[model samples]
Target: MSVSLVLTVMREAVIRILVVSGPIVIVAMVVGLVISIFQATTQIQEQTLSFVPKLVAIFVTLILAGNFMITTLKEFTEYIFRLISGM
Candidate 1:
């Protein structure tokens, strides 16, 4: 591929990755922040306090958004296959 085409593919791949990951990341951040605040207020300081909630939130996010994520990745894969076929 030409430099411009390669760059375009890279950019698209990054954007797609971010799009797929954004919800889980945001959920994890929000859960972590809330857990931190709770710890600050209550002084729990338990190591698992933040980890468990964030993990659960991320899992739930993935479950809720799995279809969208899969569809997006499928589209990207199809685009890549098309590019390969053209090449």
Candidate 2:
């Protein structure tokens, strides 16, 4: 691909990734921070405390958003393939 085409594709890929992953990542980050604060405040430093809730929240978010994420990725993939075929 020419430089411009490559840049366009990369930009699209990054945007697609951020759109697909943004919510879940944000939720997990928030949850993890909250849990960490809770742990600190309560002095309950269980090694798994920070991890479990974030994992569960991420899983639930993924389950809820799975179809949308899949659709987005599929569309992006198809677009990429079409661009490749055109090239």
Candidate 3:
């Protein structure tokens, strides 16, 4: 493949990764920030307190977005394969 084609594929792969991961990362960040605020206010610095909620929130996000993420990945994979075949 040409350098331009390789770069295009890489760029598309990166964009797809960002699209797939953005929601879960954003939700976890927000949940973690809120939990930090609550911990600061209430002074309940339990270790599991931080871990559990973020984990649960991420899991929930994955559950809710799972189909969308899968569909996106499938499309990306198909596009990549087609690009390869075309080359």
Candidate 4:
């Protein structure tokens, strides 16, 4: 592929990755921040406390967004196949 085409594909891949993972990462970050604040206030510096809530939140988010995520991935796969066929 040409440099421009390669760049376009790379850019699109990055954008897709961010779109797919952004919500989960943001939720984890927010959960971590909230947990940190709570830990600071309560002095409950437990490892499980920090991890469990974030895991639960991420699972819930994944369940809620699973369909959308699948659709996005399917679209990207189709796009790549189309590019390959054109080539």
> What are the per-model C-alpha RMSD values against the true structure?
0.7, 1.2, 0.9, 0.6
Residue by residue across 1-87, what tens digits does model 2's lDDT show? 699989998999999989999989899989988998999899998979888889899999999999999999999999988988897
Candidate 3, poorest ten consecutive residues by summed lDDT? 78-87
lDDT of 2: 0.92
Compute the lDDT of residue 41 as modeled in candidate 1. 100
lDDT of 1 by residue, 1-87 (tens): 899999999999999999999998889889999999999999998999999888888888988999999999999999999999999
Give the residue spans of candidate 3 off by over 4 A.
none
Q: Which of the numbered candidates is closest to the native, going by highest lDDT?
A: 4
Ranking by TM-score: 4, 1, 3, 2
lDDT at 58, model 4: 99
Instruction: Spell out the clash pairs found in candidate 4.
Output: none
Q: Compute each candidate's TM-score over C-alphas.
A: 0.96, 0.90, 0.94, 0.97
Q: How much is the lDDT of residue 73 in candidate 3?
A: 99
lDDT for model 3 comes to: 0.94
| Residue 68 lDDT in candidate 4 | 90
**Tens digit of lDDT per residue, candidate 3, span 12-73?**
89999999999999999999999999999999999999999999999999999999999999
Winner on lDDT between 1 and 2 is 1
lDDT of each: 0.94, 0.92, 0.94, 0.96
